[model samples]
Target: MSAPPVHDPPAAGVVRLPHTGLQVPDARLRVVRCRPHYVNRWEYRALLVRGEQRIGHIRGPLPDVAEPGPAGVAGGGPVVSFHPRGRAFTEAELEDFAAACRLDGQGLSSARVLTLLVDEYRIEQMVRGCARRGGVMARCCGEGWVHYIPLRAYPRSAGQCAAALAHLERASGVGGPWRIWDGQQWSPLSVGSGPDTSPGCA
Candidate 1:
């Protein structure tokens, strides 16, 4: 008799894998939430998840918006404003920031903790992507230019890893996505039915 034909299993809605490689699972198998921040600068952020665990996030900085110089304008006065102010955190800087946040003894609302981990991991992933693509050129103020040379890349910092686990522990108690206030109301993210559902319950 002939051997039975081999058959692949049906696709799973969600899958978990070891976090040691550069593999990203299919988007359709994950829960994703997108939020907008800074309308004037056009910043959009997204959170990614598999099952109930957050996997990562995406953050894109504002793109350049300088108009072409006027016709017949010689030299263009050195393109003084091509590069905008405000620097994104370097990998080392982000690591340090996360560490500081951990040690500061300042209590973080559950949402804030989640947001922090999401943003930091996302930034680290971007740095790794840039590095894998050889290198990237960064332009500033139209006149200033620099190349971002990556010495190392990481998916998660020590502080971020700790914070994520901590948030998850607390998250188990909170029910559903809800608002948090740091002197002001913050938008909700993720929803669940759990023990603690009140403000700052986690």
Candidate 2:
């Protein structure tokens, strides 16, 4: 005897279940690109963004140190510390960078500026000052709209991963068509910081 034919479900506007083999929508896929400053080390000085929105930049010169000796003492090998020196672009610088990117006249409101450095102590001091006065520390990472916010508080030493979260928080509170650097030029992110009630140019 012949077997019965099987019928498949309708395919029009039907929601499909998610599985390992399933394909997701292109909009849902996250793509990450890196612009490293150096090789063999974590010296990355590049802009980070999500979709069309700018997130921040990552610049670092990670240290390369050896392990301790048998007695838990310092070793004889040379102490290698990766200290890449590069200034984070300021709001004005960012405005120029953005202009170069052809994104002139764009504005950023209530945004924070973050800088990831090896010096934790310095960052801590700065953060403390900003916290007290309710101001933000603006650093130039590169020439781009993307900026970063540290997930944690500033460290207690220099060259530590100091979070620029407080700065961002303050920027948002003060109201800005704040300026930012886009590597090659500077541009505004929100509205222009005017003399009436905006943070003046830096």
**Per-model TM values vs. the true structure:** 0.24, 0.17
Q: What is the alpha-carbon lDDT for the whole of candidate 2?
A: 0.30
Predicted candidate 1: what Cα RMSD to the true structure? Answer: 22.8
Residues 143-199, candidate 2: write the lDDT tens digits.
323232322332323233222323554744533333333222223333322222221
Best by TM-score: 1
In candidate 2, what residue range of length 10 has the lowest lDDT sum?
A: 16-25
* lDDT of each residue in 1-202, candidate 1, tens digit only: 0111223332333221111111122322221555556756654456645456554554433224323443111144321111111343233432332222320123322223333334334434544466576532111111222112222222135564344334533644433232211112122222332232222211
Q: Which lDDT values do the candidates have, in the order given? A: 0.31, 0.30
Name the lDDT value of residue 178 in candidate 1: 29
